[model samples]
Target: MESGKRKIRHEFLALRNRMSVDLVAVCSAGIFAGIKKLSAYEKAKTVMFYLSCGSEVVTDFMINSAFGSGKTVIVPAIKNSGDEKMYAAKISRLEDAYLFVYGIRQPEINSGNIVEKNNIDLVFVPGLAFDIKGYRTGYGKGYYDRWLKGVPFEKTVGLAYDFQLTNQLPIEKYDLPVGIIVTEKRVVQIKGDRGADRWETL
Candidate 1:
């Protein structure tokens, strides 16, 4: 299973890397627009967003917009310790972030700015590839999986470009699925009791 996942991850990463910068920007804009239309996003007081890097769908627009709209914006920052864990840190401005972990921007570690997992109402998950079932293949660290284990699945959403969607993906027991996936083309609510009811388009 690990080998298969690694193969798929590599293939998808290459595909994503080939995408044009303009296309990523346009798709990310559409995705954020769709997110704003969700009831969960509108009602959430505190939200966690992954800072985009490389070929991933950008989150800069979403982060800035969240701050502008008075929502508490929390971003994932890597712990410098040996355990390779990640924690959510609150940021009032984008300038608070510094590049870390493969050049991905993250908020500086500050005890006063750390947010409790329960306080986060929503989380924007990152991934290299995803299936209609909401299963995603990240960069193999399992950071999101471990971090999300404690959070309710209903509050998690994956953002991806239309091309990132695949027919299916290999699943493992520890794999945490997103409640819904927002692509540039539409919003897919993975069927299950985990959260959400049906899929819809923007």
Candidate 2:
């Protein structure tokens, strides 16, 4: 099982690297559209978004757009050792950063209350690939999975570029799935608990 997981992660990372220029443009458009659609279902006043790296869908627009929408914006930064998952800290703007224990950019010291699991309203997740069933392959770190364990499944959304959508991903006992996979192209809802169905590429 460990070997299979490693292989899958390798192949998926290769797929991401091989993405074409045209695919990136289309995926970005799809992600913008998906975010528009998701705005309607959001009811939480405090929403969590993450900073992007590499080919992750650009979240700057979403973050700025959500600023005055009456919802407080929060971003996650690593707070503890690698063994501990990333933690969320409230921020008023995108530029603020503090040197957290893990050396990652985080909210200012004592800027806001520490994020308690399940206290979040909506969580915008970034990943390498996600199936229609909502199973996602991340950076081989269980950060989000560990942080979201007790949170209600309904509030989780995997935000990705369309190319990152895949037909299926290997699922393990500790691998938690998202409730919906949203790309710039479309939103794929997982059919059953823990995403039992094969993921259909967006």
Clashes of each: 0, 4
- Pairs of residues clashing in candidate 2: 30-184, 30-185, 31-184, 132-199
Off by over 4 Å in 2: 18-26, 39-42, 81-83, 98-105, 108-111, 195-202
Q: How far is candidate 1 from the true structure (C-alpha RMSD, Å)?
A: 2.2
| Model 1's TM-score against the true structure | 0.93
Q: List the residue pairs that clash in candidate 1.
A: none
Reference-based lDDT, residue 111, model 1? 85
Task: State the displacement of the C-alpha of residue 23, model 2, in Å, after optimal TM-score superposition.
Answer: 5.8
Candidate 1 ranges beyond 4 A from true positions: 194-202
Q: lDDT tens string, model 2, 26-123?
A: 77676767766765345668788886555556676677878867777778776456446567777787677555542345665354656665667888
lDDT of each: 0.86, 0.71
lDDT per residue, candidate 1, 1-202, as tens digits?
A: 9999999999999998898999889889999988988999999999999888877889988999998889999999877635577899999988878887577798788789989889999999999888766789998988889899888877899999888888778989999889889988888777666433334343
Clashes of 1: 0
